[model samples]
Target: MPTRDPDGIRRVTDAKALSAMANPFRSRMMDALKVDGPSTASGLAQRTGQAVGSASHHLKVLAEAGLVEEAPDLAKDRRERWWRLVDPGTRWSRAEFADDTAALTAAYAAEALTLQRQFERTQEWNANAASVPEWDAAAFNSQNWMRLTPEELGELSGEIVATLLRWSQRTVPDDGQEREPVFVFARGFPAQP
Candidate 1:
């Protein structure tokens, strides 16, 4: 069995888990929960535009698959149950989806939608970046072409994930401090056209 990684990510080689995550809305809910931390179904519905019942149902599926869990610490009352990601992130190889066509197709579609969401958010930030001087100065948008073997590519990917996880784990004290959530999404793929 593989051990825990520094990036707080659990690589999913199981086709069952992959199929469970195939739904676009489920993926979005997971992303929102990751960003907002522990959140109730109503909160997710407001952020994700899903009905409260629908959010609850999808969260149940994710929870059964060990993707998300209840965070009672953040709940306001007995009736409310907050959800959070079981891990900081999820990753899977192409091989994991190779045997199941439905799972593979769903996985790709979910990834495409995720990238679209990221692009939209980036545009939104770039438009208002000037108003927030700190973020504006620290924000980045860069791309470079690299020629490397598969081993080298994997090594580089691991390094980036570790660094990002370290930064992501840094929390802010809620003592009247100005704070905002930062989304750090990264992708490394072939440069082929």
Candidate 2:
């Protein structure tokens, strides 16, 4: 239900939506929709281990915010409703902040913590799967020092993001075969003087 802009990108312009997703449960719900595909509220509760009522409430909130769409499920019981993510990569406009530095900071902190937790979980999974020889494992840890204008740095960031997208496109899931989840995290910023 989220509105698509001229570029075909769904724009999450609602401040409430941003704050709603700041919650861990809602964030997990979004991730579930993106990774596991469309599912009913009951299905999401089962996957996330959340109470059915809680999942249903969060789904309603997401739907109101245009983050998700309810699809009629013909395969399931006639009464059951299926929910799907409107846009897996939806983003907010800076104008939404409108000089509210405190709100913006809080939102950024919450997002950072969520991403950190995800990375930690993935690392734990990788560590536990070390005995599995069939699992593909690779880790790259390195830093670079370079001098560049702001424009150059922005370009570099775009190139890195594009490369990662390409990698994701090349990855194909094995049907009915168990495989390790691959997690990639990169943090880059100017060094302190």
Candidate 3:
């Protein structure tokens, strides 16, 4: 989830903003803001089960990166400062890496490793469970061959993003659900020679 302005538009788009989100703690803080609404540093710490100092540090980093903004403390608590996501849909691209093939390749490798680790952790948890029906309910990876022009591929990418966003918005059942966080990653490019 992202924090949106009154017009429901994102406001952050730059390398610094993107790098801010690359850190796990800052990213988690953004998630907290999105799911729980505006909060003070202490409130976010409580909600995310993070230490107050750690949360404050990350929040400050996010604020410096323009990913979050300090809001007015209407509660009359002078010591506490409220913060909110600047725009939930904010995105950034590493313009400096636009022509760096090695850097791009490294980024892809890092993402793939992250996905693999997530899968392995889930498998470990499932192995210990007596019945893992919910685990089975999720889909992991998919790849296919498609004959399409570059423009068509771009359209397909947009469609996939929309579908994934819809899925993310779906409500999960709360019947004692012990769900693990799952990551979904999809990458497509020209086939190798």
Candidate 4:
């Protein structure tokens, strides 16, 4: 297993858990819980624009996979059930599942879904960027092409992740500043396109 970070990023090595989290809805639900904190099925449905029953079902699946857990303390009454992410985020590499063909397929599918979600979010922001001109200067899209060996590429990837982790761990001041969730993602791989 990979080393745990201070930010509580869970390293998933189990094939069953990887397969369980490979669903698009489940992935989004996990992200929602991580960002918005514990919430009930109805609240998750509202946030995800999914049916309440669908949200509930997915939450149960996630719980079974150990990605999320019930937050009894956050519930207002016995009837209310709240769910929260077991960790701030999850980390998995296809390399870990190389021995298992099925697990490797699941990991690939999960990675594809994640890339799709990131692209969709970027497109949505671009479409409505004019409505919030304040973010214009900060919003950015960047890419570069470089020649490097596998080892160098690995080092670069590690540095990028470390940089993002540092930023993620920073404490936002409670000075009434208008701040919203920001999504950050990066990819580095050998490309011949």
Candidate 5:
């Protein structure tokens, strides 16, 4: 299903497990856990705008797929339950699911959903950009068309991820500078338009 890599990412390679995470609600829950750390179903429900029962069901599904796990230690009592991402991040490649039709379909769905979510988040940021003057200089988007061999593309992807990991793992300074979670995502693929 999902194997932990040396980079601490969960590489999902199974159709069933991938399908489990393909749901819109489940995807949001996973994001919430990744961003905010371990949380109860009620907390996730609030963050994701889902009902408590719906959140619990999706969390169980995600746990069954090994994408998330129960955080018993974070629970305050027997009635309380908490969940956290099994890894810092997840990665899946369409090439990995090329052989199975069902897997390919699931992969496509997950990719499309992710792209849509990213676009929506960016749109929200754009709409509210005027209110955050401090971030105006930092917010950015860039694109360039280039030709590269598949091997070169792979290497480029690896390098980009390495750079992101460096930033992601750095500790925030104790200087009390105002800091907030910043959303960052990247995609590189062959395209002509």
Candidate 6:
């Protein structure tokens, strides 16, 4: 189960909750809610290429797991229901679920699917890179291999999230001002045993 931290983050630490989040549809719905704010099942269905009923089912599954919750305020009508992410992002330790091979595989597979989707998005951006000169110039995609103690790796991960959260808190636009959303991803893991 997720517990709200002092910072108002619904941090998920339970293995069962992580397993519940391993489904592709549920994962996609969570990402959509995080990226696009509150929306209805129909809207998410359109975005995810799933039927409305399928989308609704996935949304309910996520809600049961506490990754998302109904946002009645965003609903446009009595018939429509709006949902949003409980947290803008979630973190889990694979090691915690490792003992349960089935759950661990599913969770890892979901992450792999997410990475593949991100790669596709990057390709799409590459196709349009020339039109957005500023973004193209500012974008980052680099990798380096280095040795680090496990403690150092943990600190690095925490620092990255802290920095991103500081920026994410300011994403709301000022009056009449327009801004674009930017995605920042970091992958730091030991490649050698």
lDDT (10s digit) by residue, model 4, range 34-107: 67889999999999899999999999888888888999999889999999887767888888887989889888
Candidate 6: tens digits of C-alpha lDDT, residues 84-135: 8878677666676767886577568657876887888889998999998988
When sorted by TM-score, best at the front, the candidate numbers are 5, 4, 6, 1, 2, 3
lDDT of 1 by residue, 24-65 (tens): 778889879877778889999889998999999999988887
| Best-performing candidate as measured by lDDT | 5
Relative to the true structure, how large is the alpha-carbon lDDT of every model?
A: 0.80, 0.72, 0.67, 0.85, 0.87, 0.78
> In model 6, where do residues sit more than 4 Å from their true spots?
4-8, 14-16, 171-175
How well does candidate 5 match the true structure in TM-score terms?
0.95
Best by TM-score: 5
The C-alpha local distance difference test score for the whole of candidate 5 amounts to 0.87
User: Could you tally the backbone clashes for each prediction?
Assistant: 0, 0, 3, 0, 0, 0
- Per-residue CA lDDT of model 2 for 1-193, tens digit only, reads 4676544446665566677677777788887887788999999999889999999999998887677889786337787989998774555544467677755764675567567777777677668766755553454455788787878887787678667656654567667876544566555567864
Task: Give the Å shift of residue 17 in candidate 3.
Answer: 1.2
Displacement of residue 91 (Cα, Å) in model 3 is: 3.0
Model 1, stretches more than 4 Å misplaced?
A: 1-7, 72-78, 171-177
| Per-prediction TM-score | 0.81, 0.76, 0.61, 0.92, 0.95, 0.84
Candidate order (lDDT):
5, 4, 1, 6, 2, 3
The 10 consecutive residues of candidate 6 with the worst lDDT sum are: 6-15
Better of 3 and 6 by lDDT: 6
lDDT of 3 by residue, 78-187 (tens): 77689998774553223445686655454444345445655675687568544666556654557798888988987897677667666665687889967555556566
Candidate 5, after superposition: displacement of residue 59 in Å?
Answer: 0.3
TM-score of structure candidate 3:
0.61
lDDT of 1: 0.80
